[model samples]
Target: MAAFIIRRLLQSVLVLGFMSLLVFVGVYAIGNPVDILISPQADQADMARAIAALGLDQPLWQQYLIFLKQALSGDLGRSFAYSIPAIQLILERIPATLELALTATGIAVLLGIPLGLWAGLAPDSWPGKLIMTGSILGFSLPTFWVGLMLIMLFAVELGWLPSGGRGPTTELFGIPVSFLSWEGIRHLILPAVNLALFKLALIIRLARAGTREALLQDYVKFARAKGLSEARVVCVHVAKNIMIPIVTVIGLEFGSVIAFAVVTESIFAWPGMGKLLIDSINVLDRPVIVAYLMVIVSLFILINLAVDIIYSLLDPRVRIGEAKT
Candidate 1:
């Protein structure tokens, strides 16, 4: 296990190094942020001074080297727009994004698993058909459109919830969270559901497929022949076996949910990293952009690593395979 973890960490370091290089080059290639930062009235001398101040006047290779050095030392540079450490700004908004993503994922798993299990057990039945049909809409619908519709129905028409914003939150362990307050939960419901829709659909489909497969295995028949309760056969034997794939999908998708939340955050005016990323992009805030990219890339790698570890734990075959390798 220690060897496996060390190997994964080393792989993560290599991935991050390559990702950083690409992000650094790609960010500059998009456009010079200094162009937008400089006043139109500024002359050649002013432009030269601005360029020098930003180290833009340096060679690209040299700039990259400097960036790498700073990154290794935990300095992602200061945000051009906010004039604060880029990572610090991102960290400040981390709680909101985490809260939203976790809430969405939790809802997806809680609802999807049972629906999927039911659908899988009787794929030809009316109830199973209904679950699949609803899942289709969940998968097909656009997040932004869903968010807008939710706002229109719940906030505007019904007047049961606020349209946007992270409403009144109370600190839990020094982190402001919506789940702790009724006011916050009302505000959270729409966006969290909106963000969860796709993931929910995906989980339902994956779970159904896994369950169907697990039901056919010899152990399931053996359990039944042994006169174990139907619930025990399904829940303990079938559910545990089916969870391997579902776990992988959920782990991977969780990272995606956090990284690709820009649209949902924008629609709901949710003050999370997604919203912050949008604002940074509009003005070409390179420091913030680079920091966000690095953080996201690192998160993805780490999540996959965790999933791999879980895979090894859940299935002895995985550990055996790794040992052989």
Candidate 2:
């Protein structure tokens, strides 16, 4: 296990090193930041000084080497746009993004699993058909459009919830979270639900497929032959076996939710990293953009590592396979 973990960690380092190069080059290639920073009326000396101050005067390869060195020491550099540490700016918005992502994932698991299990168990029934239909529609609809419709119904028409924003927050465990308070939860619902729709649909399909496959396995037949109740057989034998894939999907999708919440955050005006990213892009803020991408990449790697560990734990065959490798 230690060797497995060390191997994975080494692989993660290589992935991040490659990612940093791509992100740095890609961000640098996107028009000079000096264009946006200085006035057109500024003379040659002003331009030269500004370029030198930003180290934009240096060769691209030299600048990247400098960036790579600083990044190794945990310095992402100051944001030209905000004049703050890039990591600090990203961290400040993490709680909001985390809260939203986790809430949506919670909703997906709570509702999706059971519905999918039911659908898988009785594929010919009306309720199963309904679930299948809903899942299909859930996959079909765009997140932004769904968010708008939800706001129209829940906020504009019913007036039960606020249209957007994180709402008032109180610190819980040193992290400011909205769901701690009732009002905050209300404000959180629309965006969370919007963000959850696609993920929920995906979970439903994955769970259903896993359940169907598990039900046909010999262990399930053995459980049934022993006169175990239908619910017990399904819940214990079937659910346990199927959970390996479900857990894998959940772990990986949680990272995706954080990375892809930009549309939902924009629609709802939620003050998360997604919103921050959009504002930075508009001004061509390279530090924030690159920093955000790096953070997202790091999160993905960590999540994948966790998923691998969990997957191996849940299925002994996987552990054995890794040992052989």
Candidate 3:
């Protein structure tokens, strides 16, 4: 386990480096932020001052070297748009993104699994057909459109929930989060649901497929012949076996939820890193954009590493395969 972890960590370091360089070069090619930052009426002296102040006067290589140096000591530079440390700004918003993503993922798993199990167990039944139909809508609908519909129904016409914003948050473990407060939860419901829909669909489909496959296996037949309770045969033998794969996918999808959340956050006006990242991109806030991308890349690496470790623990074959390699 130790060797595997160490090996993965080393690989993560290399991947992070390559991704950072790619991000930096791509962001730099998006045209100079100076053009957008500088005023049209500004004189040459003013332009020079701005350029020098931003260290844009230096060669690209030099600028990157400087950035690389600062990054080693945990400085990702300051946001040109906000005049705040990019990393600090990302840190401030991490809680909200994490909270939203987790909530969305939870809703997906909680609702999707049972629905999927039903559909798999009775694929031709009416209720199962209804559930599968809904899953299709979840997969087919665009996130922004769904978010708008949700807001219109829940907040506009019905007026039960707030249309946007994080609302009032109570601090939990020194981080102000909405899930702790009732009003906050009301505010959370729409966006979380909007974000969750696609994942929920995916989970439902995946779970259903897994369940059907598991049910066909000899163990399920054996459990049935042994006269075990139907619930035990389904839950223990079938459902239990499918859970490992479902969980592994869910774990990986959590990172995706965070990455693709920009549209939902924007539509809902939710204050999360995704929203922040959008704002940074609009202004070409290079530091913030770079920082956000790096942070996201790091998150994906960490999540993947965690999923690998957890999967190995749950399935001994994975560990054995690695040892053989």
TM-scores of all candidate predictions against the true structure: 0.97, 0.96, 0.97
Model 1 C-alpha lDDT per residue in residues 1-325, reported as the tens digit of each score:
7777788799889999999999999998989988888899999999999889888999889998999999999999889889999999999998899899999999999999989998999999999999999999999998989999999999999999999999988999898899898899998999999999999999999889988998898989999999999999888888888788988999999999999888888999999999999999999999899999999998899889888888777877777246463
**Better candidate number, 2 or 3, judged by TM-score:** 3
- What TM-score does prediction 1 earn? 0.97
Global lDDT scores for all candidate models: 0.92, 0.92, 0.91
Candidate 3 lDDT score at position 195: 96
Per-residue alpha-carbon lDDT of candidate 3 for residues 32-94, written as tens digits (9 for 90 to 100): 898898889999999999999999999888988899999989999999988999999999999
